[model samples]
Target chain A: MTSWMKKCLVVAASAAMTVGMTAIASADDVTLEFQQWWGVELPDGALQEIVDGFTQESGVAIELLSNPYADTKTQVAAGAATGTMADVVGLDGSWVYDFAKQEAIANLSELMEADGYDDSQLSDQIKYEGSTYMIPVVNFAYPLYVNLDILEEAGVEEIPTTWTEFMDACAKISENTDYAAYCIPLNTEAPNGIQNQFSSWLWASGGSLLKDGKPGLTDNELLANLVDYFKEMKENGYLSDGVEAMHEQDMVNEFENGRLAFMVDGISHLTTIKKESPDLNFTYAPMPKADDYDGKSGLDVACWGIGIAENCEHKEEAMAFIEYMMSPEVNAKLSQLANAFPGNSTAEPDYSENDELFLKAFEIFQDGYAINEFTGAPTAEDLMRSMNEQLILYFDGDTASVDDMLAATQEAWEAAYN
Target chain B: MNAKLKKKLTPYGYLLPTIILMMILLVIPIVMVIDYSLYDNVIANKNPVFVGLSNYAAVLKDSAFWTAVGHTLFFVIVSIAAHMIIGMVFALILNTRYLSTRTKGIFRAIYALPWMFTASVIAITWRMLLDPNGVLNYFILLFHLSPEKVTFLASRDIALQSVTLINIWSGYPFYMISILAGLQGISPDLYEAAALDGADAVHSFTGVTIPQLRPILISLIMLDFVWTLQQFALIWMTTGGGPVNATETVSTWIYKQGFTKFQYSMASTGAVILLIVCTIIGIFYVRHQKAEE
Candidate 1:
């Protein structure tokens, strides 16, 4: 070998060795607790397997603990006070206010900047107190999930195109079959998992959350009238027996059992139905409008979001972990689990990588059949959850008239606001 | 005495482990509850801000809190009375040897079914039976007893009573089982001796049977009273403390305030009031027992 060539080879070999060690030493190891409510539909710890790849790449260990449904908020509170909050936490979008009231969340603007989560992607509609506190995970729009098998079996060729036709169709389904037209769990929390669907109903019926682009939650003629119609629908056997106060899954189960023709519920439930009863033939449709702009008029959406706790000891690590979660590749891995549609627009693979019921949810989102007031005037949510609760009374025969229900509800709304 | 002292201490030593467990499990949570009760501890947020005795004062002034207390007390009084009366009556009938012990045992087992059933299932079962088109309504119509469906649980006046019926049904077997054990403890000779004196059923019940069963009855009634007072699930599951708050009990109200409304301060206030009411009742119970001693 020439002496000059040998010297060059020796220098290159030493440089390559130094570069390999530098790469090895730079990867820091850290563990993050990721808190969420674990449910049957969560797919046997599918999320853990999904996040594990991110840990492998980033060298950050993600320890997952599925908090119980009702106790999650309290557990998070305790976790925060003791400096034990999961660095990244999942919460029901509806619960954002209660958490925000306590400042249980880390100020996200700082973290979002470092994580490359910018404010421009979040609409002003979702901002709270002039700041966006949520990173949306699953954007759930309430829609009617019809057992197409039963609808077609009844010789019904078309889904109802309008609100009146929908009720008429329900009447036909009720008469022709043992199935009651719809199953509405009159006594459930957030009645039927999306009383937001009722808001969609109101929108279709010429009512809006507001007349203008503001929170017109109350003092709307059309909205109040929509409540009246909702009560009447309950009274007239449009909503079935043994349904009031039934849990959401039981409502879906009754549908799967072919006992109900229609079930109005969340978009996230697409995977739920497929896993729980794959044999059931169901199709999703936005609530039909009585007028052109009802559902199309405005949007109602709720999504589970993760926020950094305010006092996380490892704040930077938490932000890094959140940024990793939003990465296109990492989100794709989690999306493959089909627990939720990932927050990233570019991360659609987490949703579309599979060809199961998860595809159905994405299809609806693609069709623009979704809306959510993820953040709005605070009083709107309390009013919405409550009026739905009162809707149960109309089914129970506790009130002789819809006016009675509305008057009482208005009193409740006024009381809540007052 | 010194030897005896060590033997008694041995049982306490055995109890030491349980005491530690109770302190860790029950006492600590209770102490935390008391601590949280003194402040407004919003989950994961604001440091607990102590506003001493205000939660208690606020709960005292809130009419809804008082209404819940009234409903809870009403449930306890009515349920305990029904359980004691029905339980004592069942015990008296079964006390006789007209039926063999084996036959009596089968009957007891049959009646014991509801007690063994879960509270949630019991609530759901009763709700169905009481619904307008439910079994009870079907029977009522078939017999032409009432012109229309009662809608028993939907009516404000009827909802509390409807749940009380279920509560009585859920509770009687436990009381009967307890009083039956008390019944067996009474010497058969007392009944034989009473029979020799030609004491009729009523005469013996007022005299010998009642006196012998008094201690167990007191204890049983007190326990049932407390249980019924704390009752939430059955009423909540069935009626959701609704029909315009007629069935709203203190426990459900606390849950609604604390968890549903996120008003931990308000829930704490309600808790303090509930504790006070329970403590007052407990004092009366202890005094009653002391007088008997």
Candidate 2:
């Protein structure tokens, strides 16, 4: 070989090594992508505020990816298959168990312990088999949100706390007003929403959808009673005739428009209602119980939390962002901004700034959560979804008996679980 | 390389990228779907356990699957019938001899408006218009047609038909355009010749027009049926196969099993079944085309 050729080869190798090392060094500073579903629903710039606060504290640039709630599962599933999931993503409470069981999400028990964070800081609903997969960041209970003015027009003096009174009030509203007395979201597009709404009623009647971590609809007398009660209500025209097609959002819009006397909705819907109609007089009441029950409401709690993907390359940075967001101050601020219940135990929503009507609604949430029996099961969401599909027949004015519905539900559950 | 071998290899060299792309995009995924259909993977990211034909057996035995197939078939039959009947009417109207070419073009473009919009957009628009308090009910009330609002998409008896109506409205344009093209191709001399034979408008339509349009109608109907079976966004957005699974179709059921319930293997089994159905339809289409020739 010529001397000049050998010299050129050595020079080229040196340059290539230097560029490679520089590229590797540049990749050390991590950027974390955070995927969530709240962007469009949240107040303008609210997500950016949280992202900005986290980025300032952790110095990790966050790429916020907002997916619609309906498409989150599909996107996450696709991401998992492609090994391209975001570093951190917010997941619904129902997803925690499935994601963790499949190791799609990173188990954060060690990370939490190392950071001096315990389960108490977040809700226990996110734990699957006693392992933490997500840090609870927002939690809320479903309640019967009422348009107080509509009730007044119907000459109803107070919100109902028992099933008998609730039905009576609904009848009064129907007779006296142009509005539907109560709105039932029977939209099958979101079987989860329908299931959650129905569970509150089931629980209010002192029934549980799950018995021994499997579906228990067959022998659950209270559930049967609830179905019968719903049938009677539908017969009396207290529920909307359009219930079969209306989604939870549609019902929420009706409530805001004063066309619905009562709607079973989450606390976060308050933010949207307020934005749309600031003068609308609305209040939240404990979901009514069955006539024989001891007047205990069975409002179920749903939690929203953030989890790191199992393959996240920036786990430390993602954890830091989560820690910053879950701090009491930020958590409380986000909760207040979204009108949601704070997931952090130390943080409390400030309702003192609101008017009397708003205060009444906020106070019901402050009374604490109801019995949540389904959270412990790994397949709680699917099992309930199966039952919801069957129960919707009755809810949609199908002539199926309580026995038939229960049998169908039992069949569906066995199909899912077995 | 030898001249003969080089010449023979040139065509394949040009086709290599497309062949590889097809293998990667289509053939491999289909194989994977078939492989997955034989496994018992319910949870995401978990190693699938081999289960042979168990997934298929379970799906075939499940009543919900049959219900979904029934619903899907209902939707397909109703949608295709409407598309053809209405589309033929529109095509005949546009093909009228009295209409100017410019007027025909303008009317055709206007009739194709629904085709310009995405299925999701059409679904949402129709949903808003059909809401209980929406414009349709408002007009119905305005005319004192009914004392109460009609729950068009919400009622069990009507939800499937409501979705089918929407699909027909959205899909008929394609048939209209295709059939119109087919009508335009038929020589006007044949119509004049039929006229000289004393055949009236009705006879000409049933005899020459129908026979001439048979090939296009058959192809369009087959394609429309397959597409309707796969209709997801419209039903998903409108009724979500709801009011007691009244609108549930096979595609939406697969979505529920795969995305919502995380039963990947069961979903794959459903997909494989749909593939078999589509393949059968394709075979019929090919044989029908050959017979027509």
Candidates' DockQ values? 0.14, 0.61
The ten-residue window of minimal lDDT in model 2 chain B covers B40-49
Against the true structure, what is each candidate's TM-score?
0.80, 0.91
Candidate 2 Cα deviation (angstroms), residue B15: 1.5
Q: Model 2: runs farther than 4 Å from truth?
A: A1-27, A81-83, A114-119, A123-125, A202-207, A211-221, A291-298, A348-358, A374-376, A395-404, A407-411, A414-418, B1-5, B42-45, B139-148, B284-293
Model 1: per-residue lDDT, tens digit, A145-182? Answer: 78888787666678886767787777677667766687
> Which tens-of-lDDT digit does each residue in A51-162 have in candidate 2?
8877776667888888778777668766665568788988877676767777888878877777676557664436766778877687667777788899999999989988
The regions of model 1 sitting more than 4 angstroms off are: A1-31, A71-87, A114-127, A149-157, A188-194, A203-207, A210-215, A271-281, A292-300, A350-361, A374-382, A389-418, B1-61, B89-159, B243-246, B291-293
Single out the weakest 10-residue window by summed lDDT for candidate 1 chain A.
A119-128
lDDT of 2 at A7: 100
